[model samples]
Target chain A: MAHEEPINYYEYLRPNKKYPNVWCSGCGIGVVMGSLIRAIDRIGLDKNDVAVVSGIGCTGRMPVYMDFNTMHTTHGRALAFATGLKISRPKLHVIVVMGDGDAMAIGGNHFLHACRRNIDMTAIVVNNWIYGMTGGQYSPTTPLNARATTAPYGNVEQAMPICEVAAAAGASYVARTTVYHATEMDKFLEAAIRKHGFSVVETVSYCHTTFGRLNKRGGVVDMMRWLKDNSVGQIAAQKLDEEEKAAKIVRGVVCDVEKPEYLDLYQQVIDRAMEAK
Target chain B: MTETGSAENQAAQPVAPGTVSETPAKKKGPRGKVTVFGTWCKGCGICVAFCPTGVLSLDENGHPYVEFAEKCSACHWCDTHCPDLAIIVEPIE
Candidate 1:
């Protein structure tokens, strides 16, 4: 079910406010927001029935700008709050936005459990590879040997793969796409939201103001070009040798499996209890 | 700079293939005009960099201006992909 009206991005943003949003010029977070709006619009979801939740970060500020029902929750607790909202409302379309650090570091447990529970919700994890809001601190997804404010010399740890972790944690649907692939992102997001069980979309973005500057990755255009050149779709990546694939960010749907959603199972429990009473 | 607003003035010059760089195989039919909302745009140059056709160009201040509205092809690549959500590619009937 899609809207017959032509898509207008302005219709999704907060009325008469959040102009020139808090994101730095050329930030990828806004690209994700645009894709989200397009996906929701294409899916024909009413604004009032959708609840956008976000944890504290550059990405967290998203809910504040969107016109839909939104909650700006504590750092790393977006998924936790969203879980409660989803369970209680059950009918409201829930979407969670989190930064790399927020999802993989402080909120790591909640993220894993949310996936394991197979809750019906969409989580858009903006993986910018650093704690951009906190001034370029090295995040869990920062590539090995990348320079961050915390890892000035270099990061000793390998970057955590978000799609792989989500797939392993039992998320029914998992996909990855970079901001450069805007159309693909829109499609992936729509699919994730339409999935019956928990879905996670890892949006590979860059923190140009913080991460890019620290790493000397040039400017916004350069970063955008880099994303275009470095990312490879799953089908195309399959043809590349191991060494060639190692440097490329493999994108597209990682996994999709049909399964029972948490809410439906919970309804069964409630029905049984009522019958016993 | 003066030819910035008028589509006719900008379209007069036949775009040399070499000068425009790699102009992707143009999709036939349904051309559009690119509109920019200055208030919302942060002038990130995303629309300019990603426009499949050289239909957009950034001014000195970095805001995008429709360079060749005739060649837009209504791709919506710049409009939908613009980070600021400050662009709209309206099809001209």
Candidate 2:
């Protein structure tokens, strides 16, 4: 008789998918994907009822490896595609993944409206600061004075604070963490998925090959260590003065509140129309 | 698989034939078993750098070896943060 292989956590991955996933070695997007899988498993969610959507970029390729209802949509339109999916089948748990450029540049409008509409979906923006897929172009979140292929001298533009924008745009839940803080990332992701309305989890990652090499930041180990030394927790950030806080990446939940979801509100309108008829 | 000897030698040399390298180890451990699927690993070194108890270390070729499997806290940190999903920290019976 043949021996049985014990079930492993990696079963969440598609069985026939090729190994050594598409991301570059030590890319933090993989860590974010891992956190998402762990969060879904912990929630005991049925894979059949979950949908993973992504747009064009390095992070966009994630849904291809995941064993769920997955959609690899066009550039900067992941949330738009997710919106349609959520409206048509409100019961499905929709998760969208996008890179910094995909989310904040091309898809910026969709991102803001998704928050404003209070839709029930979880958006995980894996921000590596530079456009990793298209060969190190400057992204909206690239810190001021950072070097990219486009910004050879230095990036003159200020970086966009993703969590702040999400909160300001009216997302029900907004949280931020880095790839180095994997445990905290898992918790924040789980919370975002469970939240009732639009939620955003910005994972601050590093693009070692493109961004790091261009900037002369060290290898993957050094990049990972940088995340460890630079980031500050939300509460601890409060204690630090302006100068100290400015240098540290603030991590933790920025905002979370109960709100009426867009689909639920639309359903009430449908009921009212039916009554009138 | 279950690595039972000094970890330094294992890091310096490649895995010898006839040693459990392909399948998950069946050892019964108080903490758990740490399995590395060699083929799937990308030699990223994230697991090695972030392991809290110094349980993993990179080999000569950059792949991680279970340097101190006994020290693994079953924290699932290595497995969860692995970019390739190559490591599994399973609690053995």
Candidate 3:
């Protein structure tokens, strides 16, 4: 008997559709997106009850193609918009999508505050370092001295530690995964949705167009292999020195804590107001 | 697919690949230019092969560098995946 491959999430994607996935063939964003969809499926949420929100970037283009109640919002405000949407609806599965540039740079402030608030929402930040949409400009997540359009002389700025930022900002659940870690990513996203408060899933993704070109990284398959080998679990990652851990990717849930979500607190306020009336 | 539309449009467009296919609104600057930085040079040379403009060449240091800043289409193959953190595409601003 021939063995069958396990059911894949990519099957859910609309093949031969109008919205050509602007992402490159092996880009991690697609894998992350598929993992997210699988999370919703695993959680058994109705498609109508899920609202996928996104900011500007190639990752932000995701909501436009999804078959759910999605909103393609302004850059970096995806979490803020989803915050309001979740608080109002209370039953919706709100997911915010953002790219490295939109998440860690222009919309960076929003990201921190969302975690701090412990809002009842899920945030998926695809960190590919450079801005994939508007050519290759260096974003905050771009490694120091890495080349970008604005940083043609070489980026002197430090790359932000996204998972650390989320954990420090008080997110109840935080995790980091790469495009190459598909199984772990789906597992992480599934757990994030089950958590009570804010959750951040940082995906170390790839940009083969600009960052890849400038850096002379190999083709897509090679890029995936690089990500897989470089990644270490967050606990194992901590034991290594910064230089020893140089160019390494870190995956797995770094933080998971229990706290009342913002919506529940809002519900208490609403009940008090109703009693007064 | 009108026959008359073809002859009229051909005069308005350039015959070659780099030639103007459509009359763009911006005033013409120096043609296409690709800028690759040396610091990020893992030296894959995907840019040299992917350059439809055929303007990229390896520097003596073996990292891809472009001298003809005027002859690039800004396609960005060289700027995308330099594994060592070298190279970028920029207009001469």
Give the TM-scores of the predictions, in the order they appear: 0.91, 0.89, 0.70
lDDT of 3 by residue, A1-277 (tens): 0001222333444445553355554466766776677678777787788899999999998876677888998888887788889878988888888998788888889888988889988888889989988999888899888888888889998989999999998999999988666667778899988888999989888888888888888676566667867889867889999986767877788789998778788789989999999
- Give the Å shift of residue B15 in candidate 1: 14
Supply candidate 2's per-residue lDDT for A173.
98
Candidate 1 deviant stretches above 4 angstroms: A1-6, B1-28
Under CAPRI classification, how is model 3 graded?
A: incorrect
Candidate 2 per-residue lDDT over residues A1-277, each given as its tens digit = 0001223556788888888898898889888888888888777799999999999999999998999999999999999999999999999999999998999999999999999999999999999999998899999999999999999999999999999999999999999999988888888989999999999999999999999999989988899999999999988899999999988999999999998989989999999999999
Could you list the chain B TM-scores for each candidate?
A: 0.67, 0.66, 0.49
Off by over 4 Å in 3: A1-16, A275-277, B1-93
Top model number, TM-score = 1
TM-score of model 3 vs. true structure: 0.70
* Predictions' DockQ, in order: 0.41, 0.36, 0.02
- State how far residue A28 of model 2 sits from its true place (Å): 0.8
Candidate 2: the clashing residue pairs are none
Model number with the top DockQ: 1
